[model samples]
Target chain A: MNTTGPDSPSRRELFRMIGSVAGGAAMYQAMSTLGFAAESTYRGPVDLSGAPRGASVLILGAGIAGMTAAYELRNAGYKVQVLEYNHRAGGRNWSLRGGDTYTELGGFTQQCEFDEGLYLNPGPWRIPYHHRGLLSYCKKLGVPLEAFVQVNYNAYLHSSKAFGGKPQRYREIKADYQGHVAELLAKATRQSALDAAVSREDREKLLESLRDWGALDADFRYGANLLASERRGYAKEPGGGLTARPLPSQPIGLTDVLDSGLWQGIPSGDRYDMQTALFQPVGGMGRIGEAFARELGPLIRYNAKVVDIRQDVHGVTATYEDLAAPGTKLQARADWCLCTIPLTVLAQIPMNVGAALHAAISAVPYSSAVKVGLQFKRRFWEEDEHIYGGISYTDLPITNIAYPNTGYHSAGKGVLLGAYIWGQNAMEFTAMPPALRVRKAVEYGSRIHPQYPAEFDNGIAVAWHRSPFTLGCYGMWSEAARAQHYDNLCQVDGRIALAGEHASFIGGWQEGAVTSALDAIGRLHQRAIARGKKA
Target chain B: MSIRHVTIRLALAVLGLSAAAAQADDASFMPIADLGQANGEQIYQHICQGCHMPGGEGASGAGFYPKLAGDPRLASWQYAAVTVLNGRNAMPPFGLPEDRISETRTVHLSDAQVAEVVNYIRSHFGNTYADTLTAADIAPLPHPR
Candidate 1:
């Protein structure tokens, strides 16, 4: 059975078996010996050396994907040119600050009224530590990073149907739920209910672990005691002077905890992408895009929208209309083309790709999302609620209310992500006028934070469906669609290859765009070298 | 819990309900909050009108939303039903089955609701098609995954 013959478990499977038997650490070591478990696919800067002299590439969209390709290709001696639909670089990597004006489709224009230094990132806001490709560029571009708080124990978890529509503190719910579950399990263990599952000696050890893990008392029970209150906070906190004694808070009943549905919010921070050590650029997420723009200055042509993309045996040519001077069509041609235009917009453009690629392009439908930024007169979340940073989840149409992570305790004014609505809720919000959307967000958010009505100075709402640049938000791939057309979408068609968040597995993320661009260009480079040799 | 605490919680709940009711009474909030009981036109305005536009004269800029006004595609009631039920290109399926709908989806459309909206779209937007699609016609059409 252990023989290395046909029908034997492969090395990966063997390691997985080791993982099930030993643990993750031992399996990781075994896998690492086999050149696996390297985490992110990005090793370092892509080596696009030995480029054929004078090999030029015409890139579409000045997004992260396009810029990453241009920056690397240029250094590798490829004459690269990038055409952006928007006047700015960063397609979705955008931040709206004070004095900035945004005009969505249907002619609704909003000028940001946020105070100086206050901003709203309408796009990719948080960068996880595991997204090495994007982090590497942030480092290379000299963009300073700051901690982006994903979860705060003091933040809220609200459901309009639960707890009589009253919002609950995250820590209280988390502690109570864990304590009750542990207490129940301990009861089972002590009653010999786990006699078949656990060894006689291990039962005591499991109970001991549960007591500490669940904040249970010495008798392996959870109640309104100091031990439980220490985990969820005291009703009367310990003080420095007289009247210093702390009062233990009563825990909600197990049935109430189960019925509240607040337990769903507990594991959000434990998710791989949402785990701690997340970073954001100091000023805004747009800093990374701006830095890339500065680095690839003259190479990028802003306000040039590609209307037609055609390719032949010779090379690829793109017919673009310069938005500044509307009707006149300008042409750019190169040996190869890298199109980073989003699938939503690209499906509309006349790109001469094969039937499979075209079918793949039309297959993925972009998801609807709406983000509303409300500028308040003061930092009431900090001053009043003590919610310094992190998001509050709600069951209302306005799905989340994210407090600002930066400038904690600062006076004057602050901007909060009043709402991050998605799915059906987003569609409804998108249908409304921008002002009405903002008003609704305020109304809904007020349920969680009663200070909203008095504090809200102004707001700007961006409904991705109404956004003219990329039409809808990010590509939403059904498992079936990805299985059928993902490879076809990524493969090079004639002289053109596609790359963006849509083209990568890590959709709706900057890391997807970065990694996808690197992957596309690496293949493109190989093809170019081969073509160069043939030439 | 203490009696006083229970009383305070009840008061807060009452306040929240009244505030929501008052907002619902306001004309501005009518279109968005009452999706569960909205009519065909109301559903269109609340959902489909964003990308397709208020008049159904689709706008084009970064991407093109094909004009539904006098669109030959909607002439076939089955075409309209399938598109709304299964989605086509950039359009999201408004009539996905409850189990198929993503977790983020808060609203679900029934077959009758889908028919109602489809009929509304076909008749309005400068489009006049007498053939009304029934909920029975929509129920049996295969949803391509």
Candidate 2:
């Protein structure tokens, strides 16, 4: 298929069609229920007359999984109480609204192609159309989908040459710019010590390509090709393709292929491209947390740090301290409890009957990620052809960035770009102070822009690792913990329910959180019915 | 001499005009596979991770690869015909094989079977994402990649 033709349907038009149809259906439903309000909110307490004997449910954490489970269980008429350690909910799915614009600090993008009439870009960018559940959720949410531009990925090996000034694409420079890195890597593979000692030719080639890569205005196809080539071991075999070698087995190159090919699955043209949809919702991603607060209402008590969850074969009792008012302590009795807190936090949480449960909770493993958002005074890439947006280099602290204010309002002037640091770098970034982190980001950005002092400014930062309740961004499996443990994490332990992204078999993401919550609710409902029969 | 000079100028003008027109005509139809375009390579690098993956085993944040091979979705030949057109929970809408859209234009597949790479992804990664989604039964995906 030729991509440069004019007759193709723009992604915006497709989304418009989807939006009009979906919006019409939703509007029709809203009209039919115009006069109706939901029924009374009293879902009956967990007393013997209401909740069946030996049945009580408590949910901790107000994140997506916890909220989903609580909402579903409540709908099923199960007596439920949700306990959240944080003041709000939505977990990592955070949105920040300042001025007239809303920016999501976490989990920004979702893909709608997987599910018809869906808006899936929850964390920054939209997913590829292949994402089924996220697309389905988009259809459920009634948000139209968009596309990110599909382009090749490129990078420079040298730090000084590629860093600071303006970002550039690969083609704008001489075609031979990236050839040097390939040559060096191939040579290094055969001669280990020689690889460490750069010859004049290697150094010259590196500098030349760095200058050209920096001067070019084309998308770096290196990352994109790496995504395709890696699967086929393109990098494993030398000289097959530029992406054919280095990190032969992993998609790390592909991951940098485009921090988010938010446009890879959608239509052509910027009209409906995802650059327009990326935003941080007002307040925090936690504003979505307000939804839980609405449903849970006054039952949610803040600063009520939970100390223990103990069941005496009769019912479940929870002990906590009301940190809000000193000397204020409270105890709640329920037929059941749902523990949504992280297993790390759960281990520290005092549970009397905990030998087995503690072991299971402690066994779950999690990976950490660091996100740093930089608010710049101006969009420098717009001013210089040499500086392409979304430029990547190996030496920088942050490898990915996106131009967020690319909408009608953004005259391509001053814009705030979001930067992501993952894996080891993320861990390191989390340890730094706000000023230091900003300084590092600027320094990294300057490498791409020699004139960084003129184009860049300062901004704020947040470290998810330092967050008390979250402990880490989400879960990642260690070599020791196989897929079976993840499968078992979804299991319901009698009346005690588990819900959280970590508790999910899918492991680390917002989708895991939702799926796990939905599963827990179904299991809890079944348990409630079974207890009723026994009674 | 005067006549010859005028004729030469006219000939040069004609050549320049034809060259400009040719450039304009060719502008709208850039081929899908450009030697150094970088966009296709970038798309292949980033979006293919979920289905075809870095190793092309058809696995990533999503499930396995067999589900992607010869998928019915790519039959439309649109840029969005691959993984995202059908959809995945972990995958997004735009980066699928069918979603290979250009900033200035669109790409439609020449044939339905071109999506066989999805099959290649499946064969390598084993099975995932679909339940009994046979190569023969894959319906054409919605959006072109």
Candidate 3:
């Protein structure tokens, strides 16, 4: 007779769930015993207010960094509000569902290693064994993990005439050309070694030297490629490498790395390894953001897009228009504001402050990207079981491909391939009509798996450049940008703190965003304490 | 600074146009897309409340803790489907009996009912891009037992 829509479980029931099947208590005990908690607690939440109880903080852009700043500040007992221009949070970090498929359109992959899994970014993750923030946060949130397919190894380069395995008329090409490439690879390896050896402080000098050498090496390689083709009678050879032809040296130019897989053994150990670059959350990365949002509860108001930011000597006021209701305007006042919006969009924002802030923001630059997600009707990669995971397609001009089979329930019937393009290629790729884009993807995909020509049934792609909400992806650092602005980009403007992966020393990586947010939180806490002294 | 100021002004102006372009509903305050799914709370109560619970707290004790209330994993609809159909860990499979979905009435929830519950949960608890869960979303997942 008493039907109250089922009895709500008491706290005891919750605790019982933890003790029994959920394994919550056991996990907690393990975490504590293993000193995981101790290590995590050392980092601690950023100090909110050193002296008083109440302080206000404003965060811009609801991406990982802004969300993290809010989490830390709110947990530390500071009033926080996040204003996002986009209709939703998670900036360039986003996932979409289409026709029974989950595809990541933005910054997709992260590697888990050690407590702080150094993010082996699919974007700029060429670094050796560097999972830091990605792994640490997963541990913090109690998420499960799976191994990352080591795509770094086993890449084949298609040359101007043939695939990398054996160039046509290989015996005819002058030996100096091969030696030149080997020398350049060795130099790159040595420079990378030097960069790794020094303290984080002295990395700029090494980076500069490496950049100069890289340019020279690329130029020499360009000349060598032309000569190799012409003198070695390669006119009849097949044009193979993606971007097989090289361009003149300029401010920003892409060059080919050594085609051989020798770099894997180059022996420059940083902090981690590919074997440990594990990914796969118990659910997925989106879960992390959800956990952060749930903990904050209603504090995170969706559909509130901050339009304008105005600050005074006393406090900061953020002007936001409710995205759900266009005509409505909402204002929130805070003592501090953290802006984690990607630099690309941030550069265009209408600021109440003057040119100095503009100059500071303009200093941060972003590279464009077009992520193409192709879903095949069947797993064509399985044809060559040796290349079971759908080979990286490394030799092609395209980014990479994968068979996402690691999850517990994956059918292994479908194949998900993505191309991470940047700069002009990215712009061109995104600008191309969707139909043309699909055709080009199919053409290239078929080369690797003959079945792809016919087996490909349906696909979807996101030209982020066209998405008005998120104009483009994260910022990639230029050589000069790194030397000039890496340290300064993370600096807070009074109560305004900047946080995002682009704000970190390692620009264009999720680790950069989370790490920078953590750094900003630390600084905000310090400022709060300093403010107490001033009071 | 001038360029940015002008850009913002232009952006606001453009935003105004875009807003006008959007089809406005009677409840102008609530999004037009959200209004369609606003009435799903009841469906969640009647059909889903058994496993996921009434307040949407979910089955926490006995054997498997299928937290429906605020499990962060529910943010993505794909993750939401896995447990609802396959029955992860100790939770029994609800959508399909023998490896494959027998018919359109997968998970014992009709397309409308699924949409209603999905809307209820997403609107009330977590963030979902769309209001209603389409039949395509609850379509037979490629992977079976």
**Candidate whose TM-score is highest:** 1
Residue range with the least summed lDDT across 10 consecutive positions in model 2 chain A: A27-36
Docking class of 1: acceptable
| CAPRI-style docking class of model 2 based on DockQ | incorrect
- lDDT string for model 3 (A207-245, tens) is 344333332244334233434334333334445587464
Query: Estimated TM-score per prediction?
Result: 0.89, 0.49, 0.53
TM-score of 3: 0.53
Ranking of all candidate structures by their TM-score, best first: 1, 3, 2
Instruction: Please identify model 1 stretches exceeding 4 Å from their true place.
Output: A1-39, A533-535, B1-17, B23-38, B103-108
Better of 1 and 3 by lDDT: 1
Error of 3 at A3 (Å): 77
Residues A1-535, model 2: lDDT tens digits: 1123342223343345434533422111001011112121113221222434435467776766676666656655556677665555555655433222221122122111111111112232333333334344344434444343222233222222222324434331212222222333334434544334445455445334433432211322233243333332333555556654554322233123222221121221132222233223222334445555676676566655677777766567777766667566688777667777766556566675434555556554333344545544454554543233332333234544444422323342343333454433444454444455556566565555544556554444444444455554555443233343544555666557677766654445455566566666666666666666422
Report the error of model 1 at residue A449, Å. Answer: 1.2
lDDT-better candidate, 1 vs 2: 1
The 10-residue segment of model 3 chain A with minimum total lDDT is A27-36
Better by TM-score, candidate 3 or 1: 1
Q: Give lDDT tens digits, candidate 1, residues B23-125.
A: 4343333333345566677778877888888889887776777778999999888888888877777667666656565522324577887889999999998
Identify the runs in model 3 with alpha carbons over 4 angstroms from their true place: A1-51, A99-130, A152-160, A163-276, A352-356, A405-412, A483-488, A533-535, B1-145
